[model samples]
Target: MLVPMPSEPSGQTPPASSLPGPSLPTPLPAIAALPAYVPGARGDAAVPPIKLSSNESPDGPLPSVTAALADAGGLIHRYPDMAASELTARIAAHIGREPAHVVAGAGSVAVLAHLLQAYAGEGDEVLFAWRSFEAYPILTRIAGATPVTVPLTADARHDVEAMAAAVTDRTRVAMLCSPNNPTGPALTTAEFEAFMAAVPTRVLVILDEAYLEYVTDPDVVDGPAALDRHPNLVLLRTFSKAYGLASLRVGYAVGPEALIAPVRACVTPFSVSGPAQSAAIASLEAGDELVERAHTVVAERERVLAALRADGWSIPDSQGNFVWLAVGEDTGALVAHLGGQQPSILVRPFAGEGVRVTVGSPRENDALLAALARWQGRTG
Candidate 1:
């Protein structure tokens, strides 16, 4: 049986009572308007691709760590140590700091988030360079703090002088991501010292060295070296980049116990799992064998730079395990063109025409070169 209603309703709007539950919270227009985040493409059968979109180590986790993961299989039944004390002790010893001075988290990101939550609050300003790490601003806003963004220089390097000038009395945190994401240029020791000197001590400065291992520059600021001079300087490093433990999600910070203590309180209990802890510890013990990979990536990065330059592509001085290809206005077309290649290499393309190509194994590097060469030939 069919019940028919009038094709043209007898002239009235539905009563307000007919609406579903309460209306959504009055959203922050800025946040509500933000576009959805897009992760890099994965195994798309239609697109034969090599996913280099994220700045991940092309060489996977160390062999010893893999063995540790397998050995830790049975232990998954039990919860990870809530304190993560053993992993903290091991990491602290490796970094030449006391365990109390170290705080491990899911990744360096969790440490950064906790730091923001502990320090910056409503009406506080959090400063960072534009396009440094996208998460900085998002985290700041999430913590009810104002984000003070400073533009990078023409070469895409952090203009430390400009960043220092942007600081205000309300500024609670300042972050510097050296060998910065996307651009890959790091801050010189002198630049960091100057930036620190210019900044007031009340405000904390976090130097994110996520890609520290891939850097070969002698001038780059060593995390431990600056620890003594600046009490507020917190250096954040991760095992994800060179050690290839991204899946394990283990990272720690080296800083004054005052700051570290509050940040630690913000961390959720047992955030880092037992297998991750075992794998991270194993990776740290492996040491030099793991670090040697950085050297290989650096060499490959140079080759990629030269080949791109020869092909008339403008690239930046990448100190990380990745290189940046800036195609200016043609970003979309360029990405589509490059992504369309056979045994295709995918890259992290930014909103504007900047793409980051992670350094891969020798064979993978050669494949990327071939693709870039073909793209250049067609686009030039």
Candidate 2:
């Protein structure tokens, strides 16, 4: 015979012996203090807005990728491969790295979270430039680690030297976002090497190259090529931007086996859905065409930059698929003005700092330029 759980009498308490224990469950204190990650705003559904907020490619996924997705659609009933083995292998081949050194996740952000979990813990410090990827601090805090931020240069580039100096005994992870988000200039190879030399080997450094494919600058540090020279370095890249697979959510990391093994261990099982893996494999197969598309985006970015400068906007030298306006106090007003235009435009704004405008279709770019011209006239 099994013993029964005691129940209290209706509207009355039984003796203390008959009472159950308190059932309230509390979350981690760090979680309560965590800052929410705010994504870029989506426009009105009734009338579609030109979305240049998320830095997504103007062109949709490649033809091969679309066909692959359609083929994979039938397999949704089955669970994704827990290891994401084939995707990992393809990414390794593309980068010329061993399969053991590569790990794929739902997105580069997810892979980054895994890195934080593997290397950071209570009392450890994770360091990066301020106004970089907003997710950095959030992921650090979620891992029960402290986030330390150094200010970016006035020109909106990462102060690599300052970031290196900021690392201390407690610093377990340091992040570098090349073609830094919301700000466009990438870290030059010389600067990156100098920073790496200053950092202790024990401290892991992540080079986030989410927008790297969009970069046309010759001076930018090539993360994969630098990996072998610095065992502590982890290179992160994504399929969302250049491959035009934002909806699929597949990204990868390359580093030494020791570092990568732990990150792989921390990944949630089957987080990289089956369709995502299949699409990524197909995207890799269509690599040359994708590169050509990326070059087109870079070309458009240059055209937009030239136009903005001609219009008297003092923007940074953007190397990614977006331009950053150091709008400062005008951020809210500028964003609102753009949204209020005949065909509203959506952009990513970092309150009081700047606005990031993705390079879109030629017509969309022209619309954005017109809106900016109107705003400038009005404000002047």
Candidate 3:
């Protein structure tokens, strides 16, 4: 029998627990408590759907990357390089780091999982700011570590001081998502330096810079440059964003050799496919085109943010390629208005908290802006 669930005020979602409880051999409590991942909503409209739900680049793989993927596809029978040595070397060279400092994985999310597996365990505390990456707490729980979170500052940025202060003997990993997801404000250079200073060196710090390529601000924490000083700090980056290879699932980490070694060891065998590796390398070689595309995304993001703020939405300063709308209880209403429109605009909604709208092509964004205008008319 299905479990009884308390109704949500928005009336747009059924509680996750409303589904039938798991039977047979019982799952672990942490696993049981973990919220099911809610993917960006997809619309079944006859017309093409504007999928700005995930923070994916609107652009596709560059011709070079596509050719590389095609070549690698012919060699699918052979296993991928488990060490991903060539890819690692390319990333290291790009960041002026040695190969020992890098580890390649399926995606940054996979790399994070491996990092947690290597460093955290039962009774340990994994710390991060609330409303950050959805995967942070999930991965912590999966590693049997307790997830601890400090609320985001009013401006929707990390309270690094609070995070550092919250650390205790049991804290194993502390994650900082610059240009934090869902709500989009990055840690400034001074904020990051202060955080690193306040936190103990014994605890590992992960700076997930998945959206790094789109950041136009000159003062966001330069994570790669800070690596030498903070040996405990690791940078997680991906081809999935600016390089436009989301389907390939290629990402990597650069960090101190000691912390990276165990994370490398914990990754699943041959998880990153040959095509993904080839595509990632090719994407790196096509860095110029990627940068141009990233610039366009940033420009559109600024335009969108300006329009939203002019509309009096109270959005934060988003350094990422997406913007956040803290719509609160009206989240469902906003989502419904957008989704119900012709051509159907879909996005990522965090229940009653907010909506994350990825900066898409000019036309798609225009549709989004129009939808919001209509929503405002209906509500206002």
Candidate that beats the other on lDDT, 1 or 2, i.e. the better one: 2
**Evaluation by lDDT, superior candidate among 1 and 3:** 3
Best model per lDDT: 2
Segments of candidate 2 deviating more than 4 angstroms: 1-24
Clashing pairs in 2: none
Name the candidate that leads on TM-score: 2
Candidate 1 residue pairs that clash: none
Q: Give the better candidate number (2 or 3) by TM-score.
A: 2
C-alpha lDDT values of all predictions: 0.85, 0.92, 0.90
Tens-digit lDDT track for model 2 on 1-380? Answer: 56676665689767786666667898889998888898877888899999999999999877888899999999999998999999899999999989999999999999999999999999999999988989999999999899999999998999988998899999999999998997998999998999999999999999999998888788899888899799999999999999988888898899999999999999999999999999999999998999899998888999999999999999988888999999899999999999998789999999998899999999999999999999889998
* Regions more than 4 Å wrong, model 3: 1-23
Model 3 alpha-carbon miss at residue 43, Å: 2.1
Per residue, candidate 3 scores C-alpha lDDT tens digits across 1-380 of: 66666566784876576655557798888799998878777677567789999988888778898899899989999999988989999999999999999999999999999999999999999999999989888889999999999999998999999998999999989999988997989989999999999988999999999999988788899988899789899999988889888888988989989889999999888999999999999988988988998999889999998897787779999999899989899989888888888888999999889899999999999999988988887888
The TM-score that candidate 3 achieves is: 0.93
lDDT, model 3? 0.90
Q: What is the lDDT of residue 73 in candidate 1?
A: 87
